[model samples]
Target: MRERVNQDVILGALALLFGCFIALYWAPIDSDTGIAEKVRSRWSIGDALAPTVAGVVIATSGFFIALGGILRGTKSTLSAKNLTYLIFFLVIVFSGFLTMRYAGPIIAGALGEEYRVLRDERPWKYIGFILGGGGMIFGLMSLAEGRISLRRLILALLIAAALALIYDLPFEDLLLPPNGDV
Candidate 1:
């Protein structure tokens, strides 16, 4: 059997690297307008933290993934199972985001109350944080041509919980999101 090159890996790695560059250097340091504009005139340390970390992680992972693809070459097929898994993963992501963005407002309205702002972003943020981290873990571990295992699920949960805690607990009062008013 002949080994086939995975163009997706190479292209994806390159794209990730480019994204890292943009996020770390070129992306605007502050929000374009509104209260956020008054809060952070430039990328405060807190504002830059998430993107910088994410970009580095993605770029590093992309490099290893492309390398692995080159080394362990195999015939790639668009399998129905993989497609279904991908669709499920995407749905989970989009739903998490929608819930985060809408749930607060909906709940407030149902209670016949209005939030000081349009919505409270924290609860939804917590949900999204956990789900996002877990989705990533699951996608990389099980969806990527790997056999599912209980160990993986446990590890993913642990990792996701740790990440949420790291983002939400220690920095709760000290840091703010990019759009947050200081």
Candidate 2:
């Protein structure tokens, strides 16, 4: 029964990854802003695809690590709870990344260019942390059976904190004028 559930989790994660990739790559680039309207552009395909690639890689790695844990012993594997947490973390992480990418210019207009740049730089790091810490949590939960060490927990906490702090930093005001400017 648990094995079946684990299989489902793995399959679901894979499906989500594929969907995101399709949306990002194959989807039509907007006429005006280009894919820049979709997400932060690094002015190159590689940069644009980096986070998606990283997500797929980490999620794939977690799948293997989880399999290894189960094979070792069901006693040493991740529970449904752990998988839930992993999915939840990933959803928020990617959503935050997307929010910053598309909304950044408008936000920058209100805050300032510096804030925009800072905001632009954020999604990647958050993605990295989610992939890194989330992977570690899933792996350790699988191998240790809810026996994660304090240090591992702290690391994840730190990554979360870093992301939050970066997200909240205030930008200098640059509100748009009501009247059309020449």
Candidate 3:
């Protein structure tokens, strides 16, 4: 009975994985930023960019693939050494999440000043700013954990600092529409 259940689970996992791959290949492109914007890259990580929004959506479904790969690669050893790996993974996850949440708003606000949109004008916009900021904080924590290379960590830190500084200057009026939409 146990063997049968395990077989079922394995089959289900495989089915899900295949489904995700299909979706990623077939999903429609985004209207606003286009497909490329969805997968924009950060300089800190060399040239590696984010996945297309469709890619993110599909790749996220492959969590099981990642889990299986990690499990298979580690040789099933229970040791104190494993704690370091666990912590490092957690830091990366946290950092990525926070950065994703805030990066959008921060960039928007920076652009808005040229377009005359106030950074603080809308409540939801503020939320994006917070998320992006949180992501940067997480990236910093990840660096502290030594998961990212020194160069990458420094780059991430610099980008975050620059972004924070950009947020301080008055940008709303500069970005305002000629008709004065604000």
Winner by lDDT? 1
lDDT string for model 3 (1-182, tens) is 12212433344366556555444443433223333333445323211123344455545555555555445432333445678767866776666655555454456666664213433454333434345444555565655675656566566556654554465345543421111222
Error of 3 at 169 (Å): 30
Q: Cα deviation in Å at residue 32, candidate 1?
A: 22
129 in model 1: Cα distance from truth in Å? 6.5
Sort by lDDT, top down from the best: 1, 2, 3
Q: After superposition, how far is residue 84 of candidate 2 from its true place, in Å?
A: 0.5
- What lDDT score goes with residue 137 in model 2? 51
lDDT of 1: 0.58
> Model 1, range 1-182, lDDT digits (tens) per residue?
63455755765588678767856664445423222233346633445555666667777777777777677654666566788988977875666555444454456577786533532366444544455456567656775655788788778767876876686677756422211321
- Model 2: residues with Cα > 4 Å off, grouped in runs: 1-76, 108-182
Lowest summed-lDDT stretch of 10 residues in model 3?
173-182
Please provide TM-scores, in order, for all candidate models, with all chains considered together: 0.34, 0.24, 0.24
For candidate 2, give the lDDT of residue 115.
40
Candidate 2 TM-score, C-alpha based: 0.24
lDDT score at residue 37, model 3, on the 0-100 scale: 39
After TM-score superposition, the amount by which residue 29's alpha carbon in candidate 2 deviates from its true location, in angstroms, is 29
